[model samples]
Target: MSRFHLGLIINPLAGLGGPAGFKGSDGVAQQALALGIEPKAAARTRTALECLLPIKQGLHFLTFPGPMGADLLAEMGFAHQVLGQVHEGPSSAADTREAVEALQQAGVALILFAGGDGTARDICSAVREGQPVLGIPAGVKIQSGVYAINPRAAGELTRRLIEGGLVRLASGEVRDIDEAALREGKVTARWYGELTVPEEGGYLQQVKQGGVESEELVLADLAAWLESNWESDVRYVFGPGSTLHGLAENLGLQTTLLGVDVIENGEVIAHDVSEAQLFELVDGHPARLLVTAIGGQGHIIGRGNQQISPRVLRAIGLGNLRVVATKRKLATLEGRPLLVDSGDVQLDDAFPDVVRVWAGYKEELLYPVGK
Candidate 1:
């Protein structure tokens, strides 16, 4: 197989991960170390480097400046060239924007970066088309298509992709949350654009979305499917969305419509739990996450339900998660892998072979979500 040329961007402040109560990882860099949060961008970068470590010499890397991209690669002992201006370290999100331009100018096969919703937004703004890309979880709230589940999985997939393994990259919509509104328990997601998603072995992680659905029948079907599937040992964590609220209505439980709800064996255990709380609940039981796409724009995680934190996803097992969507809603996916933008690097990496979305009774569409 021929060597692959990849472009890397590191958004230092993109998601920070502070809002989820998991501590921030990319806040100005300096404060992160002091607080022991560890720079998330660096961690994400390291994940990529470590995965590429054994094959470093065979790979060509183009990256942003220190603290932005290059330095992390250097620290990981990889040989790579710096792209554009070496600004010591990217001081702000603007640096990421600048890196996007440089990567496009250099002409790369794929553009890889790490960050959450804000970082995805920055990436979307930088490049609208050209260059397939993926992400390594590094931000606070990841909600985009440019990222992989985790760093190691990214490396594994990179190997397969470069080695001529049957692989394809698809476009997934870019979704973001209203940060100000988020603080007030209001969740909002808007379409930023689309990015390339790599598909390996017909597996794709669940993608989160945000939009308005006027039809009531689709909601009704989604609710019916969820109700039929509830069983013992299946702890359901309902994410915020009208579709999810519909499920809650079927169960005769009050749902916040925009908050995380926990359903265990037909009982409402908790309502609107936080990331920590969600994980705590997950610790004791087997979980099967139930969430819906944002609508128009498709996303499964990292949009509004920050409460279902990365830790929670990890505890629940990515394979155990269920993305419930009506046929009308699934139509919006357009044969793309569902997006899972969880900010935790490990959880992002832990996603399963085929994310079994509740398509219909005994009928599942095997989508390619990851490499």
Candidate 2:
């Protein structure tokens, strides 16, 4: 197989600028030191880089000169040629743009970056269209398809792609949530577009989950069908997303915008249910877990909604799990397969082969997961 020149960049501050409540890591270095938290972002970055060490030399790699990308690469014991240099107190969007330019000049076959939507946007401008790229989840809010499900997944995908294995290729959604509104208990996501990526199959990036993250319902007919078929005996474990809430909204019941809630029949049985409570509710009554994709992250679980772990998914059964999203939302999933990271690797591997997404009417789309 021909060796590919892989570019690496890290917008260390993209998601750090998010709300204080979200634990944005831009100031985490300071916070950790103050609280004597021992390790900091540097430690976490090293941990993430360790995942990539196994296959670093197998593929030709290019990166910024210093902390922009190389510093961490160096900490990982990467002894190789460096591309550009920009070591300062912190990394920013300007540095991201410069690094992209440098990598573009170097003619990298792919640019695997680590950041959120802002970083994705910078890379988008660099590509102008599509470039073979991937993301290592590092930022606070990762609402972009560029990121792999997690750091370890990023390294594994790199290994598979570098080996020239037959892999699935598709465009992933580049969705970003406005950080400001998220602090106000409102989730406002804007669909940027799509990106071509190598699908390492089982790896799932965080995506805007559920049938609805958007407030407006374009799928009125499908919503009506779900409403008509609504079962009273069933407890609906509504995952985080605006789309699932639409099912509740259609019935004139209030749904929590950012938290998970439980619904039975046509009434809101539980609101803002905790993970333990969720398990209890599921145990007592049969429940169907419904969720949407992260706008950019493409994650089905273990991102913000840690409530639905392998135990939860198992209790509900994969057959009973309902993933709902609009055609536009599904369009965001074009290049990437439906991702399921249930925290437990064994169970995550046993995830449903095909996710039944309610695209429209009786018309549904079957998305292959771990394909």
Candidate 3:
């Protein structure tokens, strides 16, 4: 049997703005530096690739030079053909497009890219309609449906696709939120384009659309349930999004619409915290993490809530996590499991098979959770 040709592309600078409280990591290089953000795209892509190592045989990998693609694969001892010119500084969207064209010209069977929605948009621009592509979730604003639940899931899907399992190609939407407006606590998401994503048992993500009228009503009901359940002794770490922000308002507490906030005894303790700050606030306190799903992505972690890092989740424990979302938002997934890419593979696996989502006032729905 012949080998399968797989194209690999990595946006090394993606997700740098996530932990720094930026809404998205687009062109905020200087601000990301000032906020001391570190690149996580390579590490995230490697996580997916690591999952494919066992079945690496009979799979021919094609990648770009240096950090754009080849570096991590070489370090992992994979035999891959590098394409395109080697660049010194930060890789641009042009580099991604060029790599996609090169891989297409070389007749690659599938392409896997690591970045958020912007990167997905780039891929959509370069590849044809039927070209199969998958995304390893790596950026801050992942509103697109092309990304796998996480890196491990990406690897699993890739393995299934290559091993001739029952995987189907579906047109996934590429959506981008206005970073400037997002920073100002307003989400302006628009449909950019579409790309072909691999889907197996409804494992792939769906494009996010913000809450509608029904979801808004459900959020109010969910807030009522949460407000009545609050404990004075437990410190609550609230993650980002309008859902949580609305919940905070229902409790008469102010919250940063795009950053993590902490509340204890009905008082705001910390606002717009970093990962380090989250660790400090949760230390020695009975803490509970209240996070809402990204409207379209169905992600509770590893999208814009990097402030709730894997370490923080481990520290708080999964039992202390309270996920809330409107039933309408959950329905957007069409029965696909909610995803978590906390960047810690083991921690992600520790999540239970199903999580209880507070979808309405005193109403809960058991939803499947995936990594």
Best by lDDT: 3
Over 159-183, each residue of candidate 2 has an lDDT whose tens digit, in order, gives 5554432244557788777656766
Give the winner by lDDT: 1 or 3. Answer: 3
TM-score attained by model 2: 0.47
Error of 3 at 329 (Å): 37
Alpha-carbon TM-score of each model against the true structure = 0.50, 0.47, 0.54
Give the whole-model CA lDDT for all candidates, comma-separated.
0.66, 0.65, 0.80
Highest TM-score model number: 3
- Regions of candidate 2 where Cα sits further than 4 Å from its true position: 1-4, 14-52, 87-89, 202-371
Model 3, poorest ten-residue lDDT window?
A: 202-211
* Residue range 1-371, candidate 3, lDDT tens digits: 23557899998878888888777788885588677777889999989999888867756789999988888988988879999885567788899999999998876767899999889989989897666789999999889999999999999988765543435556789999999988898889999888877677432222234424365676677767777888988999999999889888877889999999999888999999999999988877799998888776779989999989887897887878978876666656655567888888888867754455666676644455655
User: Considering lDDT, which of the candidate structures 2 and 3 is the better prediction for this target?
Assistant: 3
How far is each candidate from the true structure, as Cα RMSD in Å? 20.0, 19.4, 21.7
Best-to-worst ranking by TM-score = 3, 1, 2
